[model samples]
Target: MTTRVRDERGSAAIEAAIGLPAFVLFVGMIIAGGRLAIAHQSVQAAAADAARAASISRDARTADATARREAEASLANQQIDCRSTRVSVSTAAFRVPVGQAADVTVTVSCRLDLSDLSVPGIPGSRVVRATMSSPIDTWRERAARGFRIPDAYADVWGQS
Candidate 1:
């Protein structure tokens, strides 16, 4: 009985040494997945903000500038740092004729760095992208011509 007990004394230590690394690697993967999910949500929010800002503009030229600024600001507010970032806007719909519905589209992309995970077979970076659209105000004038009050409103315009 004494001889058998001596042989088993160091087995637990040896097993722990062999299993620790695998266990740590599994935990690391879970953390990396969570980080990716956060990045994705941030990108989506940025896209939504960009589209909303652009949709309020009267023309494609101003919409383009507004979208870019809103997207950058949103990402900064969310505290997301990307290895690379891109914001794209599609304004084709804004050129529609008056009385027709129009929409502004914004797309955001970010390359998230995963180097800290130090896991093999996983890319050092991954891309996350989101797209969103917001409708342009149907009644807003598209050009600088502006809008004139209707005959019905003209009588009441100065009464107040």
Candidate 2:
């Protein structure tokens, strides 16, 4: 007598054992991607705020300070706790002659840690960068300020 073969016995359990881990891993990845995306948006907004703050300033000296402060504040407000952060501001536009179009550019970079996921081949953290520019008002008149300018930028004002 030939023995009958079973087609369905233990199949569901076996399949689940193999598939559940994959499904859970997939969901973890989705959540990680979403967190990264939100971080990107937050950094981008921080850059924009930095640029805006810089652009409204009367000179490069003040612009750099304002941009840095704004960018830091924005990141904090967004609840982004970056492992490291760097901010760069270009204030050359402030040197342009009055009545000409110019802009301030701000770039922000932040490293976000994702090591908790332990995804294979993925680094412990990823760096995100965002750059934004804001137009400076051509009609705004800048006044010489009593505040001491940083030595690094003193040459810009013809100061020895």
Candidate 3:
């Protein structure tokens, strides 16, 4: 009687050929997820900064301009290169009278590019948006009022 042995040659190579693509895909997913997370945090921070800047402005016109500038500067500082950006400021609070609680809202939108990652399932670009609100100083004077006083002085003078 004769016995035959099975040949196992090239089995390792076959396994590696199948596994390498899967490993590469997993790494790509991790990179894409990390990039998205960082972008989200950056956008949130930009919105907060913009809202704060707008809240401090004395007039609606100034608030709109200030919010846009602050958002752009904040994103640039973080070294985020956006394909497109949009900053929207809600100045309705500016119309509210002093001594009443009011807040300014700023929305920041950024289009992030991810084509270089070459991730098959992921989109070439993603739009990330964040909205933040900052309370306007209750005692601070508005454009309607001719008087303008610092927040510290407003409290000291019992403006509230």
State every prediction's TM-score relative to the real structure. Answer: 0.79, 0.82, 0.83
Best of the two (1, 3) by TM-score: 3
Q: Model 1 Cα RMSD, Å?
A: 5.5
**What shift in Å separates residue 71 of candidate 2 from its native position after superposition?**
0.5
Please report the TM-score between candidate 2 and the true structure.
Answer: 0.82
Residues 30-128 of candidate 1 have per-residue lDDT tens digits of 988887788899999999999999999878888899999999999999998888889999988667766889889999998877773345556678889
| Candidate 2: C-alpha RMSD after superposition | 7.3
* Top lDDT prediction, candidate number: 3
Note the residue pairs that clash in candidate 1: none
How many clashes (backbone atoms < 3 Å, residues ≥3 apart in a chain or on different chains) does model 3 have?
Answer: 0
Ten contiguous residues minimizing lDDT sum, candidate 1: 141-150
Error of 1 at 65 (Å): 0.5
User: Over the stretch 1-160, how does candidate 2's per-residue lDDT look in tens digits?
Assistant: 9999878989999999999999998987897888789999999999999999998888889999999999999999999988999999988886676799988899999988776333555667889999999999988865444555569988998776
The 0-to-1 C-alpha lDDT of every candidate, in the order given, reads 0.85, 0.88, 0.90
| Residue 16 local lDDT, model 2 | 99
